[model samples]
Target: PLKVFNSEQIRNIGVGGHSGSGKTSLMETMLFAMGETTRIGATEQGNTISDYNEDEIERQVSINTSILHGEWKHTKLNMIDTPGFSDFYGDVVSGMRAADFMMIVVSAADGVQVGTERVRQMADRYHLPRFYVINKLDRENVDFDKVYHELRERFGKKLAIAQFPAESGPNFTTVIDVIKQKAYKYAHDKSGKVTEEAIPGNLQSQVNKIRNELVETVAESDDTLLETYFEAGELTEAQLLDGFKSAINRQMIVPVVGVSATANVGVHSLMDFIVEYMPDPTRRPAIEQDGATRKPSDSDPLSALVFKTVSEAHVGELSLVKVFSGILKTGDEVYNPGSSKSERIGQIFLLNGKNKKNIDQLHAGDIGALVKLKSTHTGNTLCQKGKEFELPPIEFPEPLISVAVVAKAKGDEDKIGAGLHTLHEEDPTFLVRYDGELKQTIASGQGELHLD
Candidate 1:
């Protein structure tokens, strides 16, 4: 039986960071922990679920945003793994549109880099609630404390440590979860199995201090908790948990967790924190237009936005959409306000990287891919006829570099032009234009690598 998730049960999270920050590795560990995969996949080995593209595997980097889904603690999480390079930032923008929250991954050794700051700003632009995951804790010369302080100083005091390494480098096996007041030690075998243990005696004092700070910050989110704290000078674990979740949803507290993705240390704790604290899609504010707001509800009129289009060798073009208002089922007719054309919905699929699962329907706030749409492109709005509403299109940055493309074969002009058009459909950030004055076809993108 296929499990269907309601809007409130769905958590759409965008995972992003700078290149080599281990974003793909973290996702692979997550999928493994969730029982979605039998073993952890490595990016270096080109076997990661998210980096399935040939270009990405060959380059050992992600060039496009990949969507992966898993069930954690009875909650459905749609993880949007995005490219870290600025050259493919268009995919990042598209990923953000479909995500309800952002998980900013940072390398412990690298701290905050250019790509980290870019993703931070993108979270702000999208108004998505965000948290941080400091990855690569097992790397030599990595300073978790230094990176943690840097993130706090750069991002703001709102950034709070939710979990910290029990030890650094080769001994990095345990993480003390401040929120749950528990310690989890990962086996050295990288099997992702964690055993609960008491907080180490040496780290107890630090844990107490950090937990107090976390409770205080969470208490500030609600008046009742604040009053209780003032009276009792502390909060119970239950109260703190409730308050922390509220604070996280409102962006009042940005929790940070440390992990060694390759070693599988702290990955389970990180996934649990996400399932426990991250906001569900419905918790986000409603989408507004012309002083009107559209709440996520199956009873509301149908409204969805197409955020990505992928041209596959066998499937042609797949338009990935996020339902923001009502239920969308297979074989239903919908109208695209952007193209002003009516099209029948064909097969709907729930994406797990390149693997698609046939699903009968998707509720509001759920993301699914629609197959063989006639005229839909990225950022197009689809809805029931006469209930038309257009979402603001995703704003992609202007190309940073341009080059003239020439066809080597004499009769390959039309083929070149058609191929360029198809590529443009896949990536809106890449643009193609015919310069009449220069009599040359111009191709522009974020960088030379992107244009190539």
Candidate 2:
């Protein structure tokens, strides 16, 4: 077996926000900062990795979830950048199921908007470990305190500020680390490099105050920590780190970090937090039908759950799978336990936002794609032959909007139907059916705007 370097805790992160909230731009910056891409591609130029679909480029909006992978601090990070519009909420739901944590990016200047509340409620429903990012701090009229207060009021006291912007809006050059009591002033380069510095002179007091609050909130999750904090009035850096991890692990607190994803501000720190704080698949107990607990491990027989399938024009179909136990490799024979049928495994590849790189093997708790598998659909489970287990498929929201598009010419009818089928295969949230009641082919999604 080839040793995998940089193997640490794996956390699938989901990011969602309102349309024009810079979700795509944030993802672009994150990829560029991680060295996944050399040049930071812009949405306006139709070259960003996440916005690869023709529709997304032409409309200048993300229509589907763009899944990407990044490695930070030698730990692999898989992220799904989701569309924020209501019409695309279905895509958001599908993405949420694959993520262990959710990052809700909000426009700092805009405060808590409609989609913020909606996505927050959705994340709560799924019991996902959620963090809020007040993005676009470089923009004018941005109020970090007001936005922070609003989020606290909405998300409750469990909402803690992990990082705060040093300055309010434009001229924002530094951020306060609520846990470390330090400041990071980002250099004005496309590659976001920050000079470690002391907390800004003017904000030192506020920084200390917020750091204390963060420590206290984190300590609330552990009795010993709470007692120590209440009596001693402070927590050491190591204690604060431990307490913060415990708080998030127990879902007792949600950390709010600041970032100008456009300016690449706080992006590296955000990625580091995700790797350091988020729980691995093994930490999450599996839900079983017979009331028995199962955690992903290599000791058990091979088991995998299919969460998505995308059919490329030239590469055929790729099945995005999460291995629950044992090992899966190229050319291994496995059974679709959900279907009670055996199928041959093909080549395995790690998907990087529409780009696929070949890999030989994937272990339990790993996410990757398999090429040309037969008799398996999204939500199906693959395991050793004669071993049967079923994982609940992702529950997507009901379509709230519908649209009917017809071919402009007679011969275009067949092409449109085939194209719709491919689209359905790519995104299960997109439902296509012949509406007998209306005598037209209707496509249903989260909302009208999404359908458009």
**Number of the top candidate by TM-score?**
1
lDDT of 2: 0.79
Q: lDDT by residue for model 1 over 55-128, one digit each (tens)?
A: 89999989998889989889888998899988998999999999988999999989999999999999988888
Question: Which runs of model 2 end up more than 4 angstroms from their true locations?
Answer: 1-7, 403-407, 411-415, 435-439
Instruction: Report the lDDT of model 1 for residue 414.
Output: 96
- With candidate 2 superimposed using the best TM-score fit, by how many Å does residue 68's alpha carbon deviate from the native? 0.9
lDDT of each: 0.90, 0.79
Compared to the true structure, candidate 1 yields what TM-score? 0.97
Model 1 bad stretches (over 4 Å): 222-224
Model 1, residue 398: C-alpha shift (Å): 1.5
Q: Write the per-residue lDDT of candidate 2 for residues 1-452, one digit (tens) a residue.
A: 33342213566777887877788888888888888899788889999998888888998888777678877777777787788777777677777767777888888878888989888888887787788888898888888888889988877999888888888676777878777678888876647898878876898788777777787788888999989988888887788888888778677999898889777788877776787787766665565755543457766777777877877778898888877777788888888866777889878888777998888888777778888887888878887776666666777677777889788897897898998987777777788999889878899876666666
